[model samples]
Every structure is written in C-alpha cells, then in structure tokens.
Target: MLDSGLKTQLKAYLDMLTQPITLVASLDDSEKSQELRSMLADIAELSDKVSFDDAGSDARTPSFDIVRNGTDVRVTFAGIPGGHEFNSLVLALLQVGGHPSKTAQDVIAQIQDLDGEFLFETYFSLSCQNCPDVVQALNLMSVINPRIKHVAIDGAVFPQEVEARQVMAVPTVFLNGQPFAQGRMSLEQILAMVDTNASARAAEKLKDKAAFDVLVVGGGPAGAAASVYAARKGINTGVVAERFGGQVLDTMAIENFISVPYTEGPKLAAALEQHAKEYDVDIINVQKAEKLIPATTPGGLIEVQLASGASLKAKTVILSTGARWRSMNVPGETEYRNKGVAYCPHCDGPLFKGKRVAVIGGGNSGVEAAIDLAGLVAHVTLIEFDNKLRADAVLQAKLRSMPNVTILTSALTTEVHGDGSKVNGLSYKDRTTDQIHRLELEGIFVQIGLVPNTEWLKDTIALSPRGEIEVNARGETSVPGVFAAGDATTVPYKQIVIAMGEGAKAALSAFDYLIRQVPVDATAAA
Candidate 1:
C-alpha cells in the first residue's frame, strides 16, 4: 500500500501520462493495473480542455487535445517532455492559449493591429531538444492572438509533413507559407520577423528597390570569414545574421582554432566581425534571411530576401551557416545548461577542474571528452545507452586506464538534478538491469552529435541524405556561383579551423568565378 500523499502525486503524474505508459511497462502487471485506474480518475477531474481517449498502447503515442475557451488546440504529448523540451512545451501551450509574456506581449501589441494573417508551421525532430524552445515561442504567439496561427509537427511522427516541408533538421519554422527560420529562435527575433513582414507589405504598397553585390547568409565563423574575404576582394558584400556569430556564440571557448592557442568563442566572433567591418562589409545584425532566389540577370547573381521585407542582390552567395548541438530530451536539462550543464568539453572542461562531471553519449566525441575531462575534473562518469563505447580501441583503453573515470554502459539520462540555478547531479536508468541511480556531479557535458543548418536550403540546393549541404572539393555547391562551407556543408570534421579553411576555399572559388569575366586581352596583359 502506498502512502496517501504518494498515491495522490503518483495519480497526478499518471494522469499526465496520456499515452499507454510503456516507459514503466516493465512494472508488474498488478502494479500497472492499479496505477492506470488512479491515473484515469485523475484525468476525469481536470478541465474538459484535455483528453486522453485515444492514447495508444505505446507510451510514445499519447494523443491528447487541448480545448481553450471554445477553440481546440490539438496536441499530442508523446514521450517525456524533459530537459529543454519541457520548457519548449510550456511555451507552446502558452502560445496556444494566446498568453504572451510581457516581453512577447509588447512585441505583439506593436503588430496586433495589422490587417493580414501570418501563419507559421514548424517541424522538429525529438533528438534535437533545441527545436522545442523555438516551437514554444512561436506557439505562445499563436495563443495570444488569432491572427498568427502556429502549428508544430513532430518530424518523427509526421513523415508526410517532413517530406513535404523538406525538413532536414529539427526546429525548422515556416512563415507565411514559406520556410522562414531554421533552428532555435528567441521570442524577440520571431516578433521582429512579424514586424518586418508587415512593414514590407506596407513598403510594397509604396514600391521600393534594394540591391547589393554579395550577400552572406549566416554570421558564424564561416559567414564572417566569407564576408571579410569577399569585401577584401572589393566585392560589395552584405551579411545578414539572425544573431551575429550564429551557434558558436553559445559556445564558451574554442581551443582547436589554429594560430590561436585558445580563445573564447564570443571574443573570437567579435574580432571576426570587426575584421569584416574593417574590410567594408555591411553587416545587419539581428536580421534573418528568409529565402534565396536566382537573380534576373545572367551573371550568376542571386537575390537574398530578409524576413523584414527588405531584399538584396548579390553576384554570388555563400552559405557559411554552422551546425547546432544535439540535445537530450530528458527532464531538467535546459534549466541547468551553462550552470553546470554544458555541450563542449574543450570549451568548458577547464571550468570544471577538480569537479565531478558526467559525459553522455557512446560515440567517439563522448569518449574523447570524458578522457580529456578526466585529466582536468576530479572525476568523470561516462554514460552511454549502448553496451560499449564507440571510440577507437586505443582511446577506449586509455579511458579505461584512467582510475578517475567511471563507465556506465547501457545507461540513459532520465533526468538532470539541479538546484534551479545549477546542476547538482543526474538520474539515469540502466537498460539491462532496470535500475535507476542518481549520481552527484558538478557539471554535465552532452556530446551526442551535431545537426547541420541546412534545412532551409532543401529546395534551394543539393544536400546529402545526412542533411549537410553537398559541396565539391572546391567548396562549390550544385548551384553554380552558390557555395557552402563549414559544418553546414558535408564536411567530415566539425572544427573551427576546418570551417575557416572551407570558407577561404569558397571565397577563392567565388573569386575564380568572377575573374573569368575579365576580357581575354586584359587578362593576358595582367
């Protein structure tokens, strides 16, 4: 018999488990039966806005509908919305209810009087936890106002939608029937798009024209490098970034970059931007490139359109958009990020010197990070879902030899334990033994993998099945005069040096394409 308070809490938790609970299906039949009844009763007490009538046998297939005021906001709670995903869902529900936060409300108030409707559809994969945050922000907008309709489609479940949308990655947001933003976006950023589009529509009423020579789409290391290189070559280059520095800005430090022993990511990014400015590159910070179209001219020019309704014409286009880190969709993860939770060991490892930490993932990156951190941190606990580490035997032997490193095979992070401000430990389940254990740690590093920033280019360029843009050895894409470099391209290793080298290669290729235009006699004379 369970204590009354424990039973009530369990019932509340079960009620929230809309789907057939496969997550704990391993429990004895009698216990499962009792819990199901308790959960159902709890569900009956909640408002009519939520229902679990069609919950499938699989825990991942929990179907539920949200009815607000008189409007139905259909939603399916599949899997556990833990870690970054939890924050994402909350924001999504708020959006569905039209309850915008003060910040969002102010932004909304600025554009609510507009006459046109803007619809945003976002597709996301569960593996990429960052997607949920962006989706939730968009959902909040939808709830506060009817003019903005927001729909979030889980890529794994909606195969047709994924294929139709050409969603190559998670958190791809489409605005006004066209793919608008990719990856995670802030509330202010999305609102700015609405403001920009509205203003653009009004500008169209007045009629205007804008143009440039070269337009760099991203502002990370690659994009900044491309802009600087293009400007140095005397091309009228313009760069538009959702936020300057792209994903690298989130990273704390970068030690792999050549020539520099070690430098913080934000500082490096700032220097790069300054260098590009010195070369006369026009940079528009906080602006997003919504779409790219071929130029009307025959000189291999391209037209870049911004979310703000402004457009620029360029003789060439270079996509240096980098990749984003993959996240664990477990509970309590996002709440602790950067506060004892981190993604880059090389960047944040030193910060945890002499402190206990956990590294999640079975792949080479995970093993490598654990091995490296063991040398710095007091102890390292490596957790992998698979039975074995996927690292090279040599590295595995080295890691195993480290007395301070503990390996937990077939373990999955179920929840991150923290003190609201920082991570204190983690709870995980052993797949083979069905045992749950919580281990204390001062920091957690997630090295699962990376997702390229290439979804928006699905219809615009050729991409590898892995979603990375396919590029030739020269960094040229299938589209002539259009090139991609860095993690966004099909590069084997994602390092700052590699991205920078690729950016230089792409710039030279673009230059070659331009120099060919010189007259035959003039070229011979030079």
Candidate 2:
C-alpha cells in the first residue's frame, strides 16, 4: 500500500512514538478494505511500538482507529486517509502515540476540561484544501480528551451517507447528530462554539492586555508582512484575526508568489504565521473586530472594539481586513447555502460527483471552476451576465474543449431552486432574448468576484464609492494614525505580492508618522 520511500519516511515518524499504539480497523471483503488492511500491515511492520488489530465490528467498513495503549484516547478515520488527509492521519498516529503537540498550553487545558460526551463527525473530500485543518483539529481534540470523540468520514467513499445527510459541501461537521458547522473552522473557532463561556473568558483576558505600537487587524499576507516588519523594529507588535490565514486559506494554487515556483495557500499561510512568530509578534486568532475608535487626542491610543466585547488599544492600527467571495443575492441563495450552493470548487466539487451542476459568472474564477468541475460532475452549465467571456484566452479555449460543458452568455441568475432539502435547479434570464429559463442541476458554484471586508468601518473613516478604505500612496488614511492596505483599501490589483508590498509600506508609514508627530489638536489629526 505504501511505496518503499514512503515506508522509510513513515518509519521515521513512527519512531517518535513514546508509547505503544494500535490500529484497530473494521473491514469487509471489499477492495478498499483489502487496501486499507495492507496499509495497516505495512505501518505496523515499521515500528515495534505499533500494532494492528481487527475492530470486530461490521460498521463503517474500511475504517480504522488510532488508539493509545492502556488509555481511551483515540481518533477514527472512516476511509482511506490519503491525499490532503495524509497529514491528518500522520498527526493522529503521532498524537495518539503520546507525541507532544505544538498547540498552546492554555488551549490544551481547555480541551481537556470540556465536559459531557461530544460526538463529532466531519464529512470531507480528499481534494478539499480546507478539510485537513478541520479533520486534524478534531483529531487532536479527540486525542486530548477521550470524551470528545471525533470521526473523519470521507464523503466520496460513502455516497449513501453523504446523500442521507444532504451534505453538499466538504468539511461539513455534525455534532451529536446535528449540523454544527459547514466550512473551514479552526480549533479555536470550534472551542468557541462548544464552550459556552469561552467568549466571555477570552474577552476578560483581552481587556486587561497592554497597548501595542503596531497592531495589525488582519492575518493575511498583508497583515503578516506588517507584523514582521514592525516586530523587527524592536516595537510591541500584535496581530488579531478571525483566522490567521484570511482568504488565502481558501485558495487552492498560488504560482504568482515571487521566487516560489508553486505552493498551496494553506502551506504558504502556515509559513507566513511561522515567520511572524519568529520575531516578537503576538498572534491572537479567531477574534473579529466589530468597531474602530480613533484617538481622542494626538499621540494618544487608538482603540479597536471586538465582537467579544473586548477592546484593544494601539498607537497605530493597520487595517488589512481582506476580501471575501461575493455571493449572488438572489432568492433561495442564503436558505440553501451549503445545502447545494457553494463558492469553493476546490473544496466542494467532489461532493457533486456524477451530478449536474451550474457555474455562475464568466470571469477567471467561474471559468476555472467549470473546467475543474467538468472532470467530476456529469455536466456543467456555465452562466454569465456579460455578452462575452472575460476569462483568459487559454482558459476559455480549454473550457470550450470540454465536451460536457454548456456556456450561456448575457444571462443573469435570478433565483436558486431547491426541493426544501437541497438544490434541484436554478432560474436565469437571457439579456438578448428577454426569455427566462430554468436549468436542472444539483449544485450551484458562485464565482463572481470579491467584496471588500470594510463594512465595519463605513462611518469611522473616509471610504471610496465602492466601499473600499480610501488611502494615499503612503498608505495613510483620513485618520492620521489609522492606515489601511491590501484588498480592503482602494489599491488597484488584488494580488498576494502586491498586498505584501502594501502592508510593509503601511507599517513603515505608520512608524514614520509616529516619529514625526506633534501634540496637535485632535481635530487636526482627524
């Protein structure tokens, strides 16, 4: 099941096991079960402390559990944990074998103290770039506290279970047999959901924190750059983000980042967080900013209010709160989200395998999504609101070459159609013909564009007509000590490289503003 090279690498990782562990598997005579058994055998041969055993049950065939010896700590995998989930399987084995985790001590303590029996089941696809984070986090939590049991189920492997649950998106997690969440979630985010008083406790801790010299409000490529640059200057730098990787975490492939030939979004995001941590930067994850308050006096502290009822004070604030996927605001769109409407083809495409689906929009993202979906789905209908395709010529040519794709130009999506449980079709109107048509499909992938995450700052600062933060060449906004960068600002092209450059520029501009400061009137600073 594993190549010789892979076996050698697996052996090295298994050698780090501090205690005996067992691979308990439930199997049938199916081909996948045979493959899984072979893989388990290969793994058991690599380490003396590792062993394989039969689960002695006929439920969820081809599934296995990594259990620590002489303890109840274990995590279950209900299918072949390959592709993106390979890392998750490896981490589960190591963690279940008593290998130390790099999670914060406080977070670990919280996980260990959680009460009650919480059963979590996550439906995932191997092609999903976001599924591993959810799977790995739950696996680690299950290993930490046996009462919190988790099973990572491969939706592609069990089609009946996927249909039964009406799971149209990847990484859809169910808690205690009820829908908990349906997207990429961090460990901290999961804790906040299950633990009742987690937000209040966090708010109390954040309220008592000291002020910072340069406090970054986002944790994307731009925010990471600003934090590193500020921390290198021997200043108190801190970063607060809903997630450390922002929109970059959802991106599948990134080839345009300079000097890097090719890299996935999650990998690059992890590297960015690690680089920032190397300096004196303090990162606070899973925190959302609700409001921004400018300093009442020049050279005074600027305050940022969070949704958790905590406020952070800083000398200068850099707003790099990035953009998010734009949604089609038609009827039934919100009601059927995650039920049949999805924005990420890379993450949710496999769930619609062999089913008919529609790709909304005609730009690069839409065309690319159609091209990718054509391989997994039975047929793809591409809808566009323009008279012609706006995608690159190469992409257009490739998309046109696909035999199962149908393109509709000058068409506007009007409403999503669902059968109370999941999407069944959609309605669109042709601009040239003045005719409305309904197309039968099982899923809808909306890839129109991005909307800047600047709604919270609408009344606090000067913004452009399109709702983007207005800034000068030096990244200075209307407010003297408040600056903005990345896609949230009025910057032209929204690219990763450009965002990094803009972030570094904003950090330097903030530092320069701090040095050349005068105790002028608050009105002057404004």
Q: Using lDDT, give the best candidate's number.
A: 2
| Model 1 per-residue lDDT tens digits across residues 1-526 | 3456745654454344322211111112344344543443344344233343333343223222333534534333333333445455544434343443555353666545545687787766554545665776666666556676665656555566667777655567888889898755766566666674644553353234345556778888888887878788887787877777787665555776777878766577768878988997877666666777875544645877766676666677888878888889887776566667798787688889899999999688999999899999999999999998898898899999999999999998999987544689999999999899999988999999888877777798888887899999988888767888888988877777778788878887887877666544565687
| Candidate 2: regions farther than 4 A off | 329-410, 413-447, 519-526
- Model 1 RMSD in Å is 14.5
**Candidate 1 positional error at 473, Å:** 3.9
Give the 10-residue window scoring lowest on summed lDDT in candidate 1.
19-28
Model 2 C-alpha lDDT versus the unseen true structure: 0.91
Backbone clashes in model 1, listed as residue pairs: 82-330, 82-331, 83-330, 83-331, 95-139, 95-140, 95-143, 98-143, 98-144
Q: How much does each candidate deviate from the true structure in C-alpha RMSD?
A: 14.5, 6.2
Model 2 C-alpha lDDT per residue in residues 1-526, reported as the tens digit of each score: 9999999999999999999999999999999999999999999999999999976473899899888888999899999999989999999999999999999999999999899999999998776777899999999999998899999999878999999998867789999999999878889999999998889999999988999988999999999999998888888999999999888887666766789967877899999999999996989888999999999877899999999999899999999998887989898786567668887786678889999999998999899999999999999999999999999999999999999999999999999998755799999999999899999999999989778898999899999887889999999999979988898999987788999999999999988888777645754766
